[model samples]
Target chain A: MLLVLAVGPSGPSSRSEGVLVRDNNRSHNVRVTDQVQSSKVPVTVLTGFLGSGKTTLLNRILNEEHGMRIAVIENEFGEIGIDDALVIDAQEEIFEMNNGCICCTVRGDLIRILGNLMSRRDRFDRIVIETTGLADPAPVAQTFFVDERVRDELDLDAIVTLVDARHIVWHLDDERPEEVENEAIEQLAFADRIVLNKTDLVSADELEHVVQRIRSINALAEILPATYADVDLVEILDVGAFDLGRVLETDPMFLEDLDHQHDQSVTSVGLEIAGEVDEGRLNRWMSWLLANQGVDIFRMKGILAMEGVSDRVVFQGVHMLLDVETDRPWGAGEERINRLVFIGRNLDREALREQFSSCLVEAV
Target chain B: MSGLHVARIACRAEPLAELGDRIASVAWASDGSALAAGSLSGQVVISDPTDGAVIELAAHELGALTVAWSPDRRLASGGQDGIVRIVDRTGEALAEHKGSGWCESLAWAPGGGGCLGAAVGAQVILWHDGGQLETHDAPSTVASVAWSVDGRRLGAAAYGGILWFERGRAAPVSAFEWKGSLLALSVSPSGKLVAVGTQEGSVRVHRLWTGDDLEMSGYTGRITELAWNSSGDVLSVGDADSVTSWTFRGRGPAGSRPDVLGGHGGRVLSLACAPSGRGAERIITGCADGRLRLYSGTDRSAPLAEIDVGAAVASLAWSPTGDSVAFGDAEGRLWLAEVAP
Candidate 1:
């Protein structure tokens, strides 16, 4: 099978030895394109700056009759008991704790709490982790991938970041403090869905300016303008944001190899090819790319046109955790083009595009 | 011959809540006199089997993950409150150390070492005499902790692998990179090897001398419990509906296969191997279908006795003497079974 994926977690040095394998005896080839690892429950991470309406969003998710059982894990700075009356009436299992931060320091607590929940699996169907506005989303997301127990039973669905429309620009432009870690940039950089929360709090012009600023920082994320964090539950739940299927569905120019546009250190590279790839040669090239540049390539995803497969290959990675699976077959009259996208720091676009282009099968 | 009895403890079951009495862990005192059960609501119930004398102490506000009796017969436990407390005969706290995260597992060093090891979050705290606690960082969240039978090293199982800490050292002397969360740990009687059960349904054996690893897989569910026979010649592990034992003889568990002990229809929640101190090689398994069965090594297909309590069995432990077994259930009930030959 031809693999199309990005090595994520860190910039281009770490290797993802992780595998998502399903070996069953099936004769008919009816396949689902999403390949979101159906057996495990999905966890959506809600992160934003302080006062970004994360709690308001959580309260809404708690009160709504979404027909899904959600366990809310909240890490806060002080002892704000999450509106006990409201929580009790909603009949949600709310676990709140005061920790250093959800980023790296208090991930252990999150894992422990998650482990406890996994044991009593009959109670809840999904999980929503609300990070401290000051917390980083990387470590929190990494926990779901690194914990062997959690990875087996849970999937990292998406990081839904709610940005305060009125006051996010100051955070965007202000020099990052060395101690607190410029969480603002990461909140934007790592988000799968950026909710311009409280859009009414800002004027139309101001909203446009903030949106533009966010776009410059993260060119790929889908930005949704929302009032009071009110977005359809369908948009966020089970988006498989970590899987890259939605991005591929929406962006046809997924392989354009656009110029880098984010942090001075962070960049993006996209490539598209029309020829079929030899699976063996493609694997060798990918192994080399991930070995030499895995840590730098934070997120890589691609749909491949391969020599001996009617199905579109879906491949994704986060640092050293790579996943590849056969998606829905090429539709009737659809073009068999290969597309690849990589988001990371200090990407060598020219060299990578050239290296990937070499994997195409040579004409007879 | 054996007889079993259930304590008529009035724990009002309110669906998932058990009147603050859902038993999380249970253990018999090292001296084999009293059995202690820790509950999610932070209550510790110690009962004397000789008579029906029982003492219940509200030790923690939330829940306790583990309870253990030191070689000196003092009961110590760790709880969801992140507090480790040592209690005396009068149910008074002798000492308490507050860690940051949930205090999940506790193990006492064997060979009368008088050292207690605990895994609280990502750090393993070792408590020696005089209320001194030594903290060592774990690679990830520690699921279980065990001490070598000789008390030379302590092992903490987490996501990346098993970390081995030398006695009295702050750093892990070595690590076994198994790439999963290790849910259960068992050290052989000779301290020559350790067996760990992973959430990915594999039991891995690590030789203490060479760091060589052996993996035994093909289980239907995650391996939740592991126990070794007295001589440590065989290791027993549990899955969804079966208990399997693998030989640890010549080259460890490399070429060794497992003998299956069929179980109830649902998941096997807990497993206990009778202490070989009394010439018994029997394994007890509690299943999600509320069935508890004891299987002798000789008779693999038939269980010695099957009991039904109508609640999922949460945890089980064999008395050090191998004469009795104590088990706790999801609804906070405790049962004691005494066997005689």
Candidate 2:
């Protein structure tokens, strides 16, 4: 039997008003933002472990008369096929950069396939890439950050990881050969939203265990439990999960609500403070931290309150590639605060909090 | 001083025929009598440059990714549907073969026995006289393939590197190791050197039959537009906006400066070197800014001539005779230009 789950969009707002602040290379800002208009296609990456029901969700997305032409790029040829969707098969080809930058690997196949799809842009409204079970989701996410052509033409909407609630613990604890990674843990750590499927098979207490395990690794992801992948279309499609403008919509209590921990090495660290940060000090700290320990940092996102700046500085990163942008101005009477989250392995929570506090405005 | 100068040589471009869909690949016939263009909407057309005539064929229902001319005068086209077809100039299908996935790369061997090499998915299929000559599975999906000048060896570029194979061999005879993805591959006319445009914004050149390899990095973006001059002494590379030519002489391109041809306002999408034996060597660059610029390979600062093509150029080819050039654009237009001293 196949099972799937769904995630819903937090809220809808005009995503067009955000200003992207590209720090690594200033020139990319001019060209990337120039084409960020409505014509830019949104791509959703769906990843899960084996028996996680990604294909079932894909079939639902294609068969529905949603009035959008969707192109589905599947890593494996599933057992069932749908008639209407423009399905393209992809081989999982991970490409490492020659520059020797750690964690800079990307999915080379997506770069080639996406280039071909962009040529017939009129034939499809959006694209969905369903990664194979046991695939590392980081390379798929990093493709958006590394390739110039893909970065300019397509917007990475979100990474939705489907979880097999009944059998996830077994896979999570499976021992691997020394250098190989546990893909299940990495999937959860990199996810923007996670679908906890097969809820019906587990009791309330068992379901709670699975949810706690997921939250231990990724506290920011919205976990939606379902059966047979019966996810609402609106919640999963075009969520703008990567848009810096949506950073304000996150729940303020998620950072403080993490009360449990898992034995697995991967975990989440959240920092919430009520003060503005010194711009120069924050830049220095962020660059230094990412350069030194970016290999273990799977994903990070934060909405910072900069000193003397009225707008919120929002940033999100996959490994070392970070994209920062200034979001909407703070609403009148809104208390200024900073919220940040880091999901990865071997994170020292106290050290991060201390370093982050040092960058805060010093008791004015 | 801006250190940039503009020079004008006698050159003019005109629309030859429009295919009504985005042209994916363009190639000139071996005799320079016709031009073949494949469109993303699955339309293939053979056009006469001298006259405004066209013969259109529904070659690939899904879309055509590549088109090349066999030395025996047949036009071979491959498409997203994983089918390869060979057709005559009159638009009649002479032969057809099906592969596993999207057939993106096609190259006809130079010795003229009607041999063709194609990269279809992760497998390399060699076709001769309407039959499969040999097939070899690559380590990963094959991105590009090329044939040696003597037609004795074929090089297939994938994730690992270029795998060299001889005819009728089930396994690769040798390989060049590059631990990155190769986007484009080119074998020199002398058949002694191989060059590949990598996914990491660099050009890697390997000396055939030897382990000598060199890398040229620091390009503005991934190096996809690559070309080898007729004599194989020059390799022209294109990235985000500018084109650079590296001369492979003496001990090769090591420790030498490249001549930067900087003028395009957008990414250089295509590059083609003029045929050899001509009096002067020239290379043409088609850019995303909808312009074509021609430059003498030896010059660093200026283009010989340029014209606005009104769309992002997708494919470019210099005719065998070396006096004319044909380029296709994103707007499904095939253009022919006359290049003169």
Candidate 3:
């Protein structure tokens, strides 16, 4: 295989060592160009279900001697008040835009709170918002883009979703009413980092089952197993999962689809192909796909080899908004390859692959 | 072609005072003698617009969010500290009211009444002469508070709707129900209608007593700036870059087209209409691009004059006499400009 992608339960066993093999070898192949503007403040959104140890992780992030001055925004007043950490209680208010798109909603309270937080920008180096257990993460993520001031001044560093290894499966399988969303699945689908906390409570077999279940829905997120939410802070913070300049650092093996029994559930479809894509054809296909199934697509990210183009095209999207930028030129004699991943509900892998394949350049 | 052209309205602006941080709000006294400005660093300063002499008032601890000058020269300020302080023109603190959440909005009753409405979290407290008269609760945190031209009714805007209350009453006499969050509110001078900028980047107006609602949509960003002309015939709304003023003279702005004003390179942060008799149809807007422009109601294509303040304009207000405009920028600098035909 020209591309090395880890799929199914065969991923590196070193994932439990609290160190990323990719990070150690990052200097070899991955050229991470830090193109994010330095002036913008980075915000990490922490979300999980009940009993997921979200509060424990938040406390660790706050009280740990990380040498970073961080402000915390929470749903209710908690006892996490520590030294110099500005804690603000915000009421989660979801506001739907008047433009009539149902998916184009944002958190109204965050817009107000973040605008006020900007005035005291000199006091803190970063910010973290902890959402309620049952809260949907869409509105929170959308607020950073909907509000002008918040979009201009704040950068969404990453969405760190904590999973209770023993209880997450039950929560993910809970029967939801018609038109009701399973927030647990949504959280996993949208996460940039998955902290599988409380691993000591589940057996090895049970933990493997849970990890497999999670992979059936989301494949791009790097999962770290921990007990009592004791994962290293460096893995979650400053991840740059949403930064246009540096993204798609997932282990390529995760891009291979493992055919699990999925009945209209949230699933991830990853495509790895060897060839350059025609820019015009790729754009047409992407626009058509987004327009047709954007509401069902939670997140999409990829790096493409454009035909006759020296630089690689890095793109990512949340719902209907797609962001694309030109990266550094492909390394000399580097294998020309294109990789794409989609995490969403009711995704048809075959149709998506066919549509994408039609955009590839023909072999001469 | 009717009023002053973009080049004809000449004006000179001078720095009045400088605070420690970003200026949040600025208000001019009714007599145009003194200007009060509040900064996000909790500093409040009262400056003599003529000689630029400034008096430093007490700080608000957290950050001052709003400052309003009453007709009797009493300056009322509120801040993130949840304290509403009423100070006389000499910087004497007459009363201090504390609540549980940030006090972001403050309004004094017009027509010489001393009743001041302060929004401290979900409750709107009507304070009079060192005492709390009544506290009205809303469905959510109050975004703005405005007084009717006659001072008979008070309008408090929250997430669900606008609550209208009479003085000394614990319950709201009436309310205008809406679906989304209201960011800013402005009641027409005729006291017959209320206009609100919503979190959804749209402007909604409700006719008092009739409950007839009008919505103007398609703004580029959240509508945080709304102002009404003296005659109550025009309602100007600010967005990310442009200002659209709707005519409310006829059966309302229902079917009438609005006059769109552009040329500001950045977001419009503050807007104020001139007082009734003197500069009646004129409106001044301060933008994030650090420019202030004067626009006549008759012509919306271009501004009457553009003055660069060199920083994001946080707040601006017109003097009661309508001859002077006071504005504060993000750099904590307060400026007073004299406008002439």
* TM-score (0 to 1) of chain B for each candidate: 0.90, 0.94, 0.94
lDDT of 1 at A345: 64
TM-score of chain A for the candidates in order shown:
0.75, 0.87, 0.86
lDDT leaderboard ranking: 3, 2, 1
Full ranking by DockQ:
2, 3, 1
Point to the candidate with the largest lDDT.
Answer: 3
Q: What lDDT tens digits, residue by residue, belong to model 1 across residues B1-341?
A: 12142231112222222324557788888787787888765678777766656777666654677898887777888886678888875577788888766777998887575788998867898888777779998766677999987787888988777888876676888888765557788888867888888654567787886877777765544576888887888887776667777776775345445677774667677887778655467888888787777776687765666677577888888888877778787777677765441
Give the clash count for each candidate: 17, 1, 3
DockQ of 2: 0.23
> For model 2, what is the error of residue B133's alpha carbon versus the real structure, in angstroms, after optimal superposition?
1.9
* Pairs of residues clashing in candidate 2: A4-A229
Please provide, for model 3 over A1-364, each residue's C-alpha lDDT reduced to its tens digit, 9 standing for 90 to 100: 0111111111111222111112322111112223446678899999997788988888898889878888899877632335767787777777776343545677877887788878652557889999977888888887775565787789899999999999999999999997899999999999989999999999999999999999888888889999999999999999999886675777454557478444579988888888888766776666667767888899888888888878777877677655566677889989878888889987887787888888888832
Model 1: per-residue Cα lDDT at residue B72? 77
Per-candidate Cα RMSD to the true structure, in Å, reads: 8.8, 7.7, 10.2
CAPRI class of candidate 3: incorrect
User: By DockQ thresholds, what CAPRI class is model 1?
Assistant: incorrect
